[model samples]
Target: MSVTREKILELGENLIRTKGYNAFSYQDISSELGIKNAAVHYYFPSKENLGTSIVKTNIQRFEEMVDNMHSRKFDEWQQLDSFIKIYVKSYREQKKCLVGSLSPDYSTLSDTTKQELKRMIDIILKWLTELLDSGRAKNMFNYNDDPTSKALTIFSSLVASLQLSGIVEKVDYKSFCQSILDDLKP
Candidate 1:
């Protein structure tokens, strides 16, 4: 990506995570990046285009992150902790998960954006499923009644934990993550 394009995408991701997708505009990105609104248009012709681009890039980035984790040879439990950290990174930065941040606005999303969002979510869920499967196989995790449900619950909990932390913030996110990890322990 051109520096300008990358700048817009990075800023756009942060903006969307901080503000809802419907709440941000190219003008917001343009102003923050010290560029003109039309310049933002030059990179992404429409808001949907920009949103879809963010979704696509986020999906790619997340897939690459998981791939990197796999290469590190983390056992299933360790990988699960690392996976929680992936989502926690955003929370620690006071931003939202890329996919979870879109949930409330899902009904309003453009078809293409919605599809990309689903794709991003599916990728994470699939990785979680595989990890859980591995953990079960190794007797490191005992929850196997429904692997997919467990994956979804863990993800949904992490997402909720971040959102809830933003609200009352009564509990630490790391502790929240550990609770999920504990449940998986055999």
Candidate 2:
């Protein structure tokens, strides 16, 4: 990617994560980057294109994280911890995860962007479900629900927690994460 393209993606992603997808315009990115609106348009002809690209990029980064964890031979506990850390980082940054950020505006997204968003969500959910299942089998994590259900619960909680952090003052995300970890203890 060219320097300008890379900067556009970074700024676009930050805008989408901090503000809802519908909350920003190409002008927001263009102004911040000291580039003309036409430059952003040249890279991404439409807001939908930019939105789809951002979602796809997030999916790529997430898959890479999962692969890295597997390569390092992270156990189920370590995997779960690592996953939680992603949300914790987002909370500390006062930005929602890509999925959480886009979900509120999901009804208005273009079909292409919606498809990419679902694919991104499915990838994360599948990984979490498998990890939770493996953890339970290994007696590393305990929960009553099926692995998929439990994974959804955990994922939902993490996403909701980030949103809550924005509205509800003095939210202790670290303590919130530890409670999640504790809930998984046998």
Candidate 3:
């Protein structure tokens, strides 16, 4: 991608995560990046196009991260820890994950953006479900609920906690994450 295109994506993603998808405009991106509003339109064509592309790009990066973990032969525990770390990185940056950021605006988003958002969420859920199932079988994680349910619970907790930390005072983000891991400990 050209530097301008890549910068647009980065800024767009940051805006969506920090401010809701509906909160920012092409003007916001254009002003921050010193580009013309038409330039953003040239790359994304429309707000829906930019939103969809942002989610799709995040999904692609996430898949690559998972593949890297698999290649390194990360154990079930290690895999999960790494996954949680993604949220921690977002927390440190004071930004919500793409799913958390876009969910509240789901009703208003274009069909294409909604579809991409759901696909991104499903991808995470599937990975987490498989991780929980495998970990339980290997005695790496201790959880009573079915893998899918547990996956939902864990994913919800992580997203909620990250968003909550942003608004509430004195939230120990790392400890909160560790407690999630603690719940899975045998």
Candidate 1 backbone collisions, by pair? none
Model 1 is weakest, by summed lDDT over 10 consecutive residues, at: 168-177
The residue-level lDDT of candidate 1 at 147 comes to 85
The alpha-carbon RMSD values of the candidates against the true structure, listed in the order shown, are 1.2, 0.7, 0.7
lDDT of 3 by residue, 22-112 (tens): 9999999999998899999999999999899999999999999999999999999999999999998999899998899999999999999
Question: How does each model score on TM-score?
Answer: 0.95, 0.98, 0.98
Local distance difference test scores for all models: 0.86, 0.93, 0.93
Model 3: ten consecutive residues of lowest lDDT = 158-167
Q: Which regions of candidate 1 deviate over 4 angstroms?
A: none
Residue-level error in angstroms, candidate 2, position 46: 0.4
Candidate 3 lDDT score relative to the true structure: 0.93
